[model samples]
Target: MPNPDNSTPPIPSSVLILGSGVFGLSTALSLSTHPSFTHSTITLVDRSAFPAPDSASIDTSRIIRADYADPAYSALAAKASKHWRGEWGADGRYDEVGLCLVADSGKAEYVKKSLQNVQGLVKSGARQAGQGRAGKDSVQVLDTREEIERVMNTGGGSGESGYVNWASGWADAEAAMRYCRRKVEELGRVNFRKAEAKSLLYSGNKVIGVELVDGGRILADLTVVATGAWSGKLVDLRGIASATGQVLAYLDITQEEQDRLGKIPVLLNMSTGIFVIPPRDRVLKVARHAYGYSNPTRVPHPEKHSESMVVSLPRTKVDEPDQWIPREGELACRKALREMIPSLGDRPFSYTRICWYTDTPTGDWLITHHPCYEGLFLATGGSGHGFKFLPVIGDKIVDCILGKTPEEFRDKWSWPEKGKEDGVWTDDGSRGGKKGSVLDEEMRKGSRL
Candidate 1:
């Protein structure tokens, strides 16, 4: 385990990054361009090709907002929003339709703090600089559900009160990921391999590289496990971080409906963790950002070969191709649709899936060197809010690798002390819904119905 002291480690000659999602891919891009790692050989390996179908990073749309209960993350997201307004967001990849964030009585605190943070950012002129016409006078407080509905421009809306940050928006997730992958390919410095990491290759206590599922070893001077939800399979995340599956249900709409709904702001209710990103390609998605279902499974311990441990890992369509969101999730999505957009309440979901997030108890990302392994670094723990930071997260991750973690995130992203798995649900205030829902149990219950 590495200490949290500001002591720089020598740049490795070869760096192997496992996983190609935001964390891994961004690190690869940053390492390929960073001067310190100019001579380093970077290899990115993932179970699937670029933009894995089951990855949380690949989707129809994702919210892009600077709104956060914490000022630090709000500021960071505001900085990232600048990039979303620029080249990274071009070519129909980003949509600046604004984000309407609301909350009920029970969850109003998070919304209140988030409003203050975004308002502060606006006051400090840290945000709204590059947002064009949409940037000016962006933060608008919605005192009631009616005001929220007005901002949403939809017939209905959730939450008792909230605010709308006109500067915020949404992005075409898959397109942005593809754009990122293409940029990495253009660099030509990284070697991208499509292979599943069976386990970490270790020499004593240090991770030397990764052993592929196919029984081949890829050695590197440093190994970065950025496998997102499946990181627990490679590293004993245990109570530090776990994989939780969030629900997403997409409904197909008529062209007329799309035209009408396309211009509406992205609506999110923090109380229920239900959100509606405006329609794209006549497909409207309703998702929950709650304390999601966990799929616990026993697997060989990465550090101890003879022992196996139960960890909450992702069981996506990749593993069960026909898998769908559990009935509880579907009903939640249905209810959200009825409350948020009454006109489409009866529409059937064209598709539904569980998106897995690498969640930490504090909702902070886990981005630091392994506490016990000298050559292993972890760049995971997205905690459901990592996608918007895509433009700047990589460089920040690189800084951590060089022992220069940002002052604000130094503690937030560091390797945390392990706790009991039963007590590890994220209490970030933003998360909603009942805790401790097991995926298998939920699926079995759904099957019974």
Candidate 2:
């Protein structure tokens, strides 16, 4: 919780942002040009160079849709859709192909509420104007599996009922990220550093800055941690935030197959948490938006001395370059392929990777200042859906930093209370699959296969 008086913190002379992913990079961009921060020095640091290869932000594709069950997120996503349709989406960066969202009888609640939200947006004409070819008829409800199959055009259907939002689409994630990075560089207002942050430099209760892995120190008046899944290691986020690794499997297809499937809408079944984004460049992707595997490791608690705690952090290719998803995840993806696109059922996966998400208990982002630390602020907890807001999230984050959090997101983005007695598993009605999976255990199980 922020100060009860609602007094805004003084604008710092120097702001140091850790992590160059969507949150950090966007904050830097916003801080650089914002009128109030004209004299504030901005420094952006990341372990890898721009577009960190192992980052969740660096991906082949990401969904850009506003079909959320929560009206706030749906409205905000619709606002971002406008930017995606503008110059930000130029040069093949974005595509408005459409998204087929479905769910079976048991898990149909989310899809039902999502459909209603989008329909409301459409009826209010908010989802009509910038939808390109999907104008006016942007959303269409599918009453049966046959209707879902017809919209998918894949000769198959998923879930019992759903709807298709043509206004929704996908984006070349890396391209859009690079575009934002270039825009940040062109401003020349930020000092970019390629270095790994070891931990936060705490001066009593106030965070002074960051300590580098090489025993170097960089001090700043304000520090923002936007390290995504890696944030837990830099801050004590135990019950507040954790890293969950989601599985992604890609298959190489022929040019003809790509052309045939590329025109179809992105299919996502909330019931099973399986999704297949249309193929691009002869490669098709199948993934799950479920409660992902947790990689729990013991590390020195950020704010405690001679004490350690177990936190679920990311274990990516950056640490083990040869890493692949667990067999259970692979099989889940296989099942999705067999049921959705039967033609590719027997095809082998060209490659598989685990995409890490910084998940909070409620699926809301932690964008407020640390409840106890004076100079420390957090801008993470993407929970697998932050990429779509890349175009506009930074400015909103800056607003939160300045104590002007948008009314809609004030409570949603605030520092959450301690998690439940069992553990933190996002139950936002969107995530599916089993919870409480351990990464190492799953990997060993995969080895047995």
Candidate 3:
């Protein structure tokens, strides 16, 4: 354990953030916005070139709803929604389409809390609005099953359903991230670049820098590993975090169908694990969130989770090698849409791809300091729900680095949860390799419109 300079600075003079996705970029941008960090040397690194094509943050649209069973997210989303309204606005980037919460029986813990929270907030806002106070929180009950079916244009679209927070909508994720990166760069202290971080460069009990995949090393006073799904490989995250693959398909609906369902809100079928995003430019997105794919026996659960950056490559082979959408995923998605929006017809998907999620047990992000290494921080563990907090999550990261994170959320993001038992690869049987991958022939078709 030799020190590069045998120095340990109380505050980081230079900060290196790995990954350029939503979490990494947000932390970088938030650092630049800070009064002291404005002049600090900050570098944002990414494995891919500008706007990584396959990055989760590169999706065409991202849901901005705050309908979480946990009120922390709901309240935070309420705060960020205000900024999105004033800043992003309806300038072709953000929308206020809201999210339609549909459930199998409507009694699910997640769905029930969502409806109660949203409706309560909406009523509170309404009372305030009557007294000359105005806010965006708005909720509307679908009333009868007939109304839900009518909205979905199916005889039985959902058993229980409602719309939450008319202010909640979808945002162009890539556009927003690009905007944030530009703003961070304009601050003059932050630089964005393309480079893959191989591992952490440690000296004694402190992390001094990161080793690049290209044999070069970046030495920084503080290093933040925000690489998301790729995080476990570079560090011994153990079960605290691991990569799980999910599917996303882009479908092109007829103008008639688009007109009918375009203005409709996002479809969140909590039971069916299908999320049908709002139709944008006649292209609708369908995503499934449930049991996912992991590195089967190749990656077993680690006994302890920590800040150790040891490269333990997972050998478990993914069913879909070329990253194509599988037939299993396709059929499941179609079935969900068919049940939810029967009017859309049983058409084929235009484009589909598989994406990996860095999952955690509680679904809370891991934005805390490394237990074993000084000058090292863990800013990953998005767990598939990290995008919506893009606007403010970075600020909290700064707080954690500066020892200012609020008391309530610190434990949730910290170690020793109920069950950090992850890193095991569980297959969902969603791949239909018989036709090769989805990128092969029929899965993705160029838009003919």
- Which runs of model 3 end up more than 4 angstroms from their true locations? 1-9, 123-137, 152-156, 162-164, 296-322, 417-449
Tens-digit per-residue lDDT, 301-391, candidate 1 = 9889999999999999889888889899898889999999999999989788899999999999999999888889999999999999999
Alpha-carbon deviation at 22 in model 1, angstroms: 0.4
Q: Per-residue lDDT for 80-132 in model 3, tens only? A: 66666657544656776667676666445577787676666556562111111
Model 2 CA deviation exceeding 4 Å by range: 1-5, 129-136, 421-423, 447-449
What TM-score against the true fold does each predicted structure earn?
A: 0.98, 0.97, 0.83
Backbone clash count, each prediction separately: 2, 0, 0
Position 123, candidate 2: lDDT: 82
RMSD of 3: 6.7
Candidate 3 residue pairs in backbone clash: none
- Per-candidate RMSD vs. true structure? 1.5, 1.6, 6.7
Task: Give the alpha carbon lDDT tens digit for every residue of 34-59 in model 2.
Answer: 99899999999999988898899999
For all candidates in order, the CA lDDT equals 0.90, 0.88, 0.67
Top model number, lDDT:
1
